[model samples]
Target chain A: MSEHHEKPEISPAARRFIIALCVLAAVLVALEFIIHRHAYFTTEGQPLFFAVYGFIAFIVVVAGGVGLRKLVMRDIDYYDQGERDE
Target chain B: MSSLVTLLQIPGLLLVFGAAVVPFLPHKLRQAYMLAIIALSAYWCWGIDVGTHLSTNLAGLDLTLVRAEAITRPFALVFHIAAALNVIYAMHEKSRLTATSGLAYAGAAIAALFAGDFITLFIYWELTAFTSVFLILVSGTPRSFAAAMRYLLMQVSSGVILLAGAVLLWHGGQGLSIQAMQANTLAGGLVLLAFGIKAAFPFLNGWLQDAYPEASVTGTVMLSAFTTKLAIYMLALCFAGTEILIYIGAVMTLFPVFFAVIENDLRRVLAFSLNNQLGFMVVGVGIGTELALNGTVAHAFAHIIYKALLFMSMGAVLYRTGTAKASELGGLWKKMPLTMIFCIIGAVSISSFPLFSGFVTKSLTIGSVAKDGYFVIWMILIFASAGVLEHSGIKIPYFAFFGHDRKFEVKEAPLNMLIAMGIAAGLCIVIGVAPHLLYGLLPYDVKYDVWEAGHVLGEMQLLIFAILAFVFLMVRGWYPPEIDSTVLNTDWFLRRALPRTVNALSRPFLAAWASAVAQSKTAILAVLHTGEETSRKSGLVSGVASTGAAAAIFLAIFALLLLLRFVA
Candidate 1:
């Protein structure tokens, strides 16, 4: 079975939601500089460290999942194959 | 929290036997009765005070029937709370077997929390397994049957290992008490391995993902609360400061996030999320500070509630729509708005949003890690935090409620389910808003300010940006589409490779056995041939008078043999 290639429908409400998310992200990014962040490690003190790390980590995790599917995903009945259904 | 060591009989064990009669009661009466039993048990746990030795000698071994650590009180209290909640959550179900077993399972776990010695612990260890397997079996599907067997095997294996560890402790001249021990020792390692399997440490976690999702909806809700948390409680007691667990836990937190992202079953996604949540607790155990231990206990308490809420919401979805696969579920928010809200609350709580249970409780563990200066681990945990948002915090709600609307025409979840979720959601908020309620129950004082400006801002930034990435992926069609497929985990070892390997290895022996059977068949056939051939030697039976000739031949051979013997 092929992966569903259906693109999500973005309505006016969804667009507004995305815009709000973007604004929230922008505000958080702005606050990273304004908020005197306590840094345990030296690199943690860098500008926009958390935002960059979080955004990239989320992408990596999702993208990594795509690659993982190729290696591990089996037919839904993989475990049931050849066994009589109880 | 009490360091009370007394051999007084605790009353939690009675709930197990009390459940035996649960099946006989009328449904409404049974619910009320079990709740009363649980309330009574909670009262028992609340009444016990600390610091006296009271172990009875059984067969020359001091069996500690009653024990309490500083951490024990909260665990015992929450377990009773969960027992009561389970009764309410399953109130609408008619299956007497589920109620009876679920209540018994909770009882066994609570009893275990008070066990001062390893022997007592082992009994309850297997008791929890034996009771909980019924929940999985109640699902009544072939898939669930197979999963139940595997789940039982892993669980029983853990108990057997616990027993063996206890025996080893005795042989080494150490008493069979459940005290902190060095993991490098054989007995300690065996005990830790036992706890690790139940704790769902990395590779051993397959059963959690395999079985929990396969349970009956109410069964899943009940199953979510007890078994694994019991394991975590044991791990914290036995293996705090064990360095390997820190690394094991970090991998545990990281790997599941990726699997959860591609997992199509919403319930299975939550199971994976449970594994990840356990990792934070595990890291706290490994850190072994007062703060870390407190974190572990607090996290378990909050985790049980929110995790059960998450499972219950999905349970509602499964009950109403008859499916939990994300590929088939969407737009449920339209029909089940309240359930959707509860699910989102669960999602946000698990995601550690600043004003939820996970935020306050989970911070202690992360703070402990940061304070301990395990930089790489701290980083992995942070990344995994974002990953939590990806799967649980976002994917569960987004796919089940808001994603490409599947237009399910189902009604809202049952009244009982909503009530269960509402109470749990309220607890999450109460604990989050006034952290001290839970803090006061901790084994040690919670000095970490969860509401600190810096910590809250950083957590918000992490979550907010992760949301941005999700939006980015969705707009670009870059997100992996949910497809219903078997996502392989360590269980593949038992279900596939182990069986296949055994069959392959037995081929030569099977062939030898078949050949030996064929050789034996030939020998038997040869012996039968002589008896069947009466006229093989024509001279013996000879000419015309066949019956007389045969009789004369037999007499002549007998006479000749007698003569030959006489001559010899």
Candidate 2:
């Protein structure tokens, strides 16, 4: 009973589905790297420019994480709260 | 004499007058009248050509209804589209109150667009405030009523300041022609404040978040289009390149993303996102270059459709499920596939994914800002742009349509609602695919292209990369779930804090009134007590004093006879 209040339980199938999505994303990103190596799918700058790219990517990822932590959300009764109680 | 042709330039005014009479019509005829007026308003706005300036002096000042090919045309055109879309959206809605108020709202905004002079503009400005509040009232909710009143007060107060500015302008010897005024004058400052209120300039933008979410679904769609856009149009015309709006726009753009992120209400999220979007236009308007102005016009056009689409989808969710919170809703895509698809399209458009309406239009504003060498503003805008993607792009559709649907089962949006959403979704794609369709309607000829390789790659990098981040969060189960009653932005300043502060400050004065009553009672009681004591003392002393006087008189009579004999 206390466990129910702790958090809604995530089903095993849903958890597997989420893992599969993650794997799929990683594979797609790796494919982009491979395809770019063959003189096709050129990037804005050289893909090997790790120092500059890594810094920029890190900032973006960190900023995105911060934003997700801060903003990216919805509420349970966002539409239906505080109404018709006159 | 040919200038008088400008009067015919906006036949939408007469149609507005007709719409005001629509509600009074017998029940069956009401909708038909509303539809006819909408059609007529559309015709007047789109059919009118690119040249006609009607100017006749009211009092030595040029009260020119000059139809210059500038901001008004595009603004008016969007108003026409919004009015028609709103009418179609409300087709199945039975509320006569919403119908009348919606039409009157559109009419008032259209009138403001064609307003020849400051006086005309101010009148229509207030009218927009007056008519739109009814849409909220018809919702029959106490919260809606309160929100509408706040919306009305703020909107009307903005109009009052505008009117005051016009009066000052007339007195200060600036001619009444609807052109740019210098920022130095009293009228100029007043007008800026008025426009600031309407434009949802940073601190003054509370009314939007307060009111828009509370209106009826169709009412919110109509609400999204007119009020803030009208202020932008006015600001574009009168205060272009004022320099201050640049920073103002940047702050407006960046500040709302935080609030929007934390916000629970789907409608209010859109409202915050709108403030952010308007900041882009304000930046462009402040830039005041031809391309920047074109960008502002084009963005407003695209934004109207996409924003309305987003609202429609959410409204449908609200209608069917009876709730729009992310926590309560999950796995709804199975039920509302069409709405989901339309919502995704709206999301893509707002996110400015390459080949969407937002991509084609919003880039011009950012690009122009960059070209103008406002590097700091440009960087802030880029950061804000990323924030926009985080909040509106991923969060909206993800939570509502895609995320853990919390296993709630609900029917798809009604056919009427779907049709409305479909129309909006169609417009979004059309604007994205054929940017010229929208760009052609712009006040200036825009040579800027949105599909250049550099532009496409940059946007793709930004949006796709952002999506990767969203995916990362969801996979980790680190995302914030929708909750109930998210705190509102700037509105807390006026809605919660201001009223509380005033009450606290006035408590002593309130107590003083009772104290005054107590003091008056004490004074009257003291007077009565004094009278009672004096009468009692008089009664007690009278008998003794009279008896003593009688005894003294007897003794004095004998003494006086003896003394008289001696003296003789």
Model number with the top TM-score: 1
- Candidate 1, B96-157: lDDT as tens digits: 99999998899899889888899999999999999999999999988899999999999999
Candidate 2 Cα misplacement greater than 4 A, ranges: A1-86, B1-10, B24-29, B50-62, B65-68, B508-516, B534-568
Deviation from native of the Cα of residue B11 in model 2, angstroms: 3.8
Give each candidate's interface RMSD in Å.
2.4, 8.3
Q: What is the lDDT of residue B100 in candidate 1?
A: 93
Candidate 2: residue B426 lDDT (0-100): 90
lDDT of 1 at B74: 90
Complex DockQ per candidate: 0.61, 0.12
Clashing pairs in 1: B4-B51, B5-B52, B7-B54
TM-score of each: 0.94, 0.84
> Candidate 1 — which residues are off by over 4 angstroms?
A1-7, A82-86, B1-9, B52-54, B534-568
Model 2 chain B is weakest, by summed lDDT over 10 consecutive residues, at B2-11
